[model samples]
Target: MGSVTTSHELFEVRRIAIIGAGPSGLAAAKYLIAEDSYEQLDVYEQQPEVGGVWFYSPEIVGVTPVPHTTPRGPPELPIWPKGSPAPLFSNPMYQHLNTNIPKPLMQYSDQNFDSQSRLFPSRQDVQTYLIKYSQDVRHLIKFFTQVADVHLVSKDGKDHWELTSRSIITEEQKTVEYDAVIVANGHYSVPFIPAVQGIEAFNAAYPSTIIHSKAYRSPDAFKNNKVIVIGSAASGLDIGTQISKVCRKPLLNSVKTSSELKLEQENKEEVPPIAEYLVDERAVRFEDGRIEKDIDAIVYCTGYLYSYPFLKSMEPPIVTNGRRVRDTYEQLFHINHPTLAFTALPQKSIPFPLSEAQAAAIAKVWANKLALPSKLKMIEFEEKRIEELGDGAGFHVLGFPNDARYINFMYDWVKTANDGFAKEPARWGSELVHLRERYQEVRKKFVEAGGQAKTLEELGFEFSLKY
Candidate 1:
């Protein structure tokens, strides 16, 4: 972590810039707008509209080659002639994707999913909900503008941010200064494909034979082909199930451990991680010495990297190994420079309401309505968290009860700073925590019953004060 001297004087943040108009960015905007202190608020979104990754397009970007040893940086921007279309960045949403978390738990604190939405909302449904939520702050967003760089600039012995952004359509570039910056840009863009032996030769022999989930749109092209799906995470399980239906019998599923092979479907066979790829034989050898030959395609459902090419200029780098962001206190504020904050970095938890909680804390702190702990204390908190969670992706994971506790912690933190004037963020009670805990089980039942249930009560699940 970087070190900085702590000052007792509060830094007056009047102008703020938020990157990415995703769920977290929208939440940040809502909370910041609610505070009457900020003189100007701007949101930079690369996409022409909001919804972030939920905004789906049929177009698929070219896949990064297999055996990616280092973190993948941002794609180079093309210089398009006037009136030419801007480049498209693909999201990792498949055709049949549905929310794993139930609607009640996935929704933002201020709004509800539509009455017609299913228990596990589809991609379109969630996109619609986010678009609706972003209505109030739409004016603050600069669509089709990509933030190219954010670096610290010193003026009057205080640190400020210089943001440079490019217009995706016109290729025009501009630079601006802000008192504070909120990095709500998501971490799900760059795909992380583990390095495997002979992967480059295999790709050369059979081009497009391997792909990350980010490039996958549908299983139609994989029909009747011998497929191997890598990783046992959420996308792996979902995409494996979908591919198994149309592909050959006994789809090879590769996982890190026996515990990850949860699905017991006959068409899917769990195998150990890949030991090597035989380029000549079009085969893969598992760690258990099992070999599968003539494989048609290998889909890496492995997750994405925590990439921020725009913040590359910052000293004491924020991202390392593409697994975690460093120097963050409570996984939100930058320990050395509190003005530069990040939200929606944690995984294995619902994102909507969690983003609201984080945004509330950031909004209050920047508005001088909330006071953060001293720099030394904040550094101590980071050190303590690293001791408990280690220094990897686990540091950002807030699973089960920990996630619930975090939400309430932020809610209470904001309340303490409030003078009964600021808007409150989400505070999960016992009833909501119970719902969040059992949502996976309830979703399973809903799927088994042909996914006809629209509400939790329809599936025999209801909220109770007592856990």
Candidate 2:
């Protein structure tokens, strides 16, 4: 919030500053470079290399460690400290962790996976792809540089963004001005740990016994230990199952709290929500009045929060709370000053392709080739969205079918804007759209079919039902 302007005319955006060198940042650089209007593009990344959260670092340093807590079972990761400085280290990408989505669905619109790669590639494969993509626009990136602050300055009836960055090694500070800023810093670093009633007592009794999933690196560390995995989401289930192979007895504590909980039912599976912790007996008490003793460790699979400490220093802070951003139109451009800044497309959508579409669309808007909805219309959209989804988590959460709608909007915009009017920014073709639709259709059918069927040989059937 620098100088308030009454005019909504398109401003000439020649120089752009992109924060973070992750997929979104790289995609922004790619599209902006493709457009001839943008002359100078700068990408700032905190890490020594290109991959933002994908690059796995062995050492755990400069991290905002999960604080102590007390709970019935294991403690949740503490709330992200608002207005706090960025940690020195990055989020952990465990060794055996693989992509949850298939390679075909996760690939960028313009890029393809390696021919020899598997369907669900490893984290290393994704990091490699990001690195290769970074190489395509390496000239624009300033490695080992961290963006400290971004301030809005109005000069001669126009808005300009001034970004201050510091080198991680030498600690030298420098400030540069740009016509626009793209917050490409992805939301995987700062963990969102829930609070528990008796977590502090438990942590004091058993030091280093409870940890967040971000601290988990390998199953070897949990071997012969009695582990309790909190949450039943993808990471929680996958990590718990992996540790169960080596651990003495690993219990999966699901907060789903549903009577209709459906699972294959492994040997040591318990489905009660945690009620409280028994510090005296060092046991876990569930809501069902059952007590579990001799529990060794707990792993929290709670996700990360969208924390941008850098934006707090702005004239008027961009992030209102831990929940959502303020005055963002379509979750992309700033409603008041559309030209000043934009938060890259968010939610649980296909990362690379969604980023590609968003980057292209943003480039169009910055180039004055495309127009956004009226300010009143934009505010109405956000209000209606919050009404349907509720506040905070509900607002940002995008499920399967909803993701299709969002991406399709970007695709449609790219197509409509390029209809013989302005030079076309790279278009996300029908191929990607078709892939999402077909993937959703197949997934729906598969989910409805429920658990996997036994092989024909095991069932002793003459013919398969799939045929």
Candidate 3:
């Protein structure tokens, strides 16, 4: 017997499974396909459409505005893969919701948001743009499918792994072992509804009115109703604002009152894997039968969890601090599971660009699997922050450095871009491109806020035109 059954074989991966089909997943598919690395590709999405987290994601569905506000009909469908449908972003959306950030600032920098478009295009416009992006790269995905689990195995007694996926359609499960797996499922899959103390009794009492933020789409259902919104993130705040206009005297920011007055509420149940509880370190409590000023609906805009039900089989535990997927710096590789990687984890603004950049960089070093930043450093950072903050709750947005927020993203984009998989633009071409114009337009606003402005001449710009 020649060395028994040897691990001499090199793994041949024919297909790669990219989860979640949102901006991150779509971008990954675009790069992998455009790179021509794998012969076959599959994209698993829980949503019917291609816009992950945008096409009415479970998190932001509460703020998706009212339905069909467009004067003109929806945009024409883009050219997709034969039998594969066009993106859902092209569908009509509610009118009240406008992009919080301006469109020009939000574009991929390489892609234009149409010159005739509004500064802050409606949610519908963003969706349409996403749909167009998917159609342009439609050859790359298999939609309406989902990944139930992914495991790293020593198949054939080798260093390679097999990937197992389950389709939501036909209730069929399939396995396609890949040399690599990209978990692009994103974060919004599991809605983190804070189950308060009386929540059980309340639902037992008012089952019809108690709704998670995920199910909410427009105010039409909430009109004239007394609403009580929970949490204070952008999602929660936005819902409260919307309901205030439509509902009668919405109790805005009532949940935040505990923290505002430094009143600590005791023994509230915490949501696991995410250290923070539904109630803040400071919480709101009332006597029996007094449910916060006679509110009819309690909209739980409590946010999302870092849910990877697929990773339940993996041992050694992936420890997460609050909303963050911790122990992994920059939220990429794992300290334990080296063969697997996840995308769509946002450390800060415009998470897609940064995530795409990081993934592409890792792909170059794909063979160097299990390469993690030192565990000691990771442990040190986490402990230090846990000590400083006293409680690990919500996003640590400014958690990194001054330059890291943008630089990390720009760096990741270079990998596939350099290989011509994605367009490699010389300049970052972010807001910096419009810096001078922006400065000229808003210098007054900054000065009004007791700030000083440096002119182009002073800031080292030689201008041709007279001021």
Taking all chains together, each candidate's TM-score versus the true structure is: 0.95, 0.83, 0.67
Question: What digit string (tens of lDDT, one per residue) describes model 3 on residues 333-431?
Answer: 443343456775654344545555655544533422213345566556556755664334433454223223444454544533334333332233434
How should the candidates be ordered by lDDT, best one leading? 1, 2, 3
Worst 10 residues of 2 by lDDT: 70-79
Evaluated with TM-score, which candidate comes out highest?
Answer: 1
Ranking by TM-score: 1, 2, 3
Clashes of each: 0, 12, 6
Q: What is the lDDT of residue 448 in candidate 2?
A: 38
Question: What does candidate 2's lDDT look like per residue over 1-467, in tens digits?
Answer: 44443226765789999998888888888877876678889999877678777877655543334442211121112222346333245366888876655566677765666755544567888898888778878887887787877777888777788899887667799999999899988766656666666766777787777788887888898789777887766677567767877888535555654312223335247557667777888878777788877788878777766667666555455655456666677778777777654544467677776777778787877887777777788889888888898767667777566776676677678666643323232333455445554543333333335413222122222321110
RMSD from true fold, candidate 2: 7.1
TM-score of structure candidate 2: 0.83
lDDT of each: 0.84, 0.67, 0.49
lDDT of 1 at 277: 94
Candidate 2: residue 186 lDDT (0-100): 77
Better candidate number, 2 or 3, judged by TM-score: 2
After superposing candidate 3, which stretches have Cα over 4 Å from the reference? 1-15, 34-40, 57-96, 156-159, 255-291, 319-322, 367-406, 409-467
Better of 1 and 3 by TM-score: 1
lDDT of 1: 0.84
